[model samples]
Target: MTSSGFEALLEAVRGPASVNVLVITGAGISLASGIPTFRGTDPGAVWSNEVMEKGTHAFFQRAPHESWKMYLQRFELARAAKPNAAHRALVAWEAWQEAQGRGFAVVTQNVDSLHEDAGSRQLVKVHGSLRLARCSAQGCELGAPRGTVPMASVDFSAFHASPSPETVPRCPRCDSRLRPHVLWFDENYTEHDTYEIERTLILARQSRVIVFVGTSFSVGVTELVYRRGRKLDARMFSIDPSNASLDRGIEPVTARAEEALPELVRVLQS
Candidate 1:
């Protein structure tokens, strides 16, 4: 981010008597840790139109193996990757917030568990974790009405981009098929228990500052939060490397998460 831009954003946050903070993240935050983003012309992006198309429940029902094939490779990458400086920066910020007896929370779209590992509490993983699995038969009583999150049982250690029928993951309960515990391209945030969509929206509405980290308002969750923030007049900041439009009323800090977040912690701690 430009020094002036960064200073402007920092000043806004510091100047405000803002009482609550809401941080929203996406794949860009994990990019430094070697996980790829989902879209755009980036050659290393994990999903293409066809791959994203395969992320639907209908596609899963028709070809469970293919769906798993797409997810498993990404999960494998997420498994091996470590949290980068940006994740730790947020952890530090959260610690500061706690000491001040102020409200702070993260609502991340990333399926990776890096934020949890980095010790962020009061977090809502709007897109479920790749570290978990659930039954394919919706309303399976394994976890009951809400469908409990179970550790991913299907061994994906040997997984590659091409999975066979025998490689399809199965639910430990009911011996039914297991699907990745992630919100699919076709699914709404309300469809699952883990998303905590309603609670997140409420928090966004309540926040005095809403930081958009690594996401560019591409999905429903971001849109909802943006609308609420507009109504509430939240001091919003957007941290990103891309030239995302500035029409959203969010003060822009145009830099990658890894490069910008440590600086953010420094300024806040000072």
Candidate 2:
């Protein structure tokens, strides 16, 4: 791991009056979490290309049990992964800012709650969380919080025993199929989620500086943070080894988040 550009950018952004908000993206931050990279040159992703292309909607339509199995596998991996140095640094930064009468916001694209585990005060989980499950029954309003333990108890081998088979998870309340409470690829983002994001964006705009940590800013929702931050006239910094498809006007800091964030924290603390 090398030094991060975000750290250097953070140094420039720290000031007396203006609030500092940090919007984190996917891939770059999760590198320490042991999750496989999707876009880059990695070839050994556990899921097939069809699964990657289709996501939950396609899988659930075909084989619901298999979909659940795949989801659980990923969930198990994320659950085992602990919060890295970068995550702890952000949490510390947030604490420091809040203590000094400033604000700090952490908006993450990754569904894993590593930031939450690190005790981050302000967070926006844009992709939704895998640690929860919702009822699949039509007009179902109740959501069941299925954490790591419930998910691990699922008998995936028994569920995928037949061809054209669908495994419907029992809802704790209504006994309907338990749907993973993640925002699928084709589904529209929930209005509630959008509202929270919009509020965070407004807060970010008010900040004097915005940092894009451990993200490439490639995808739609993730990229919007960078675009909006730039529009607000806030100084921007990105930390990634690769700057592929970076939009104009944002400074690219070619480095990993783990190395960069701790160093940045040290500088800020000193």
Candidate 2 regions off by >4 Å? 1-8, 42-48, 143-166, 191-195, 244-247
Best by TM-score: 1
Listed per candidate, the RMSD to the true structure in angstroms reads 2.5, 3.7
Q: 1-270, model 2: which lDDT tens digit per residue?
A: 234455457656576656566666675687677876555444534334565655666667766666776677778888898999889988887877887788788877777878899998788876677776666655555442222124444444645565224446566656666666676776645533432567656666777777777654555565566667767777776777676666676677777778777777777777
Specify the highest-lDDT model's number.
1
Residue 267 local lDDT, model 2: 70
lDDT of 2 at 201: 63
Q: List the residue pairs that clash in candidate 1.
A: none
lDDT of residue 56 for candidate 2: 62
Once superposed on the true structure, which residue ranges of model 1 sit more than 4 Å away at CA? 16-18, 143-145, 155-163
Provide the lDDT at 182 for model 2: 71
- List of clashing residue pairs for candidate 2: none
